[model samples]
Target: MSPTIFYGQTGKFTFRMLATVLGGQSICILLGALVARAIAATDQGSGSSTAYLVVGVGLGALCIVAAGLMRRPWGVTLGWVVQALTLLSALVVPMMFVVGLFFLALWVTCLVKGAKVDAEMARREAAAGGSEAGADDDGTADRVDG
Candidate 1:
């Protein structure tokens, strides 16, 4: 297969991994928060932890939506929402567990994969000596321009 095809596949794989990891995290965090509330029920009003539940649900929704959308606009929006909720609900550690620091690491991997794929495509395109890649006036490859 072509380098573009291979790199593109790698990029796609990374994207999928990011989505799965983030989605899984959101669910786990929501579950953890529920467990915490159950344990705390003996001490105070269960209703008192409403903020935690709400944030967990919201963040979990965001992560789910983000995972569904991947790198699309909705995905970015949902990711921002998740990040905002994470910041606002800093008091809840379990929420982070569900939201996933591991997914953050996966996201970095996704970025690297995307960048590598892009670079490979650009290189291949340039080596093919296409005008789109800043070929010389005669269509020969040029070291610079694009």
Candidate 2:
């Protein structure tokens, strides 16, 4: 059996990593929400705290789906949406403002660096292709000894 290769553009990898981070963050948010609910229970109730749970879980699921959708053109757009939602989460959990900012920085870095890496990879592939074509036309092997 042949081993499957998962090679692709660097941007995809970056987005996948972002998705993973978002999913993990979602779980953290859920835990925080539960704690918030317990605290609020002594005073008010779970009514407001439930919003955090719902939004947290929902964002987590969205991130997972967005990761899969990275192959599509709209995948990046979805990522932006996730970022916005993550920032908006600060409204509920004040600490999320800090966490969200950190993630936002990471997301931006990924996009910028991913594009650079992808461009370099494409350039290298094109050069390799050109070299291969020249060798074939000259009836020579494309490898060198020593």
Best by TM-score: 2
TM-score, structure 2 vs. true: 0.72
* Candidate 2 runs further than 4 Å off: 1-28, 35-39, 134-146
lDDT of 2 by residue, 46-141 (tens): 566556566677776777777677666677677778778877877766787887788777777667666666668778879888878647667587
In candidate 2, residue 8 scores what lDDT? 33
lDDT, model 2, position 32: 54
Stretch of 10 with least lDDT, candidate 1: 1-10
TM-score of 1: 0.55
Instruction: Assess each prediction's global lDDT (C-alpha) against the native.
Output: 0.59, 0.66
The TM-scores, one per candidate, come to 0.55, 0.72
Worst 10 residues of 2 by lDDT: 1-10
Q: Count the backbone clashes (under 3 Å) in each candidate.
A: 2, 0
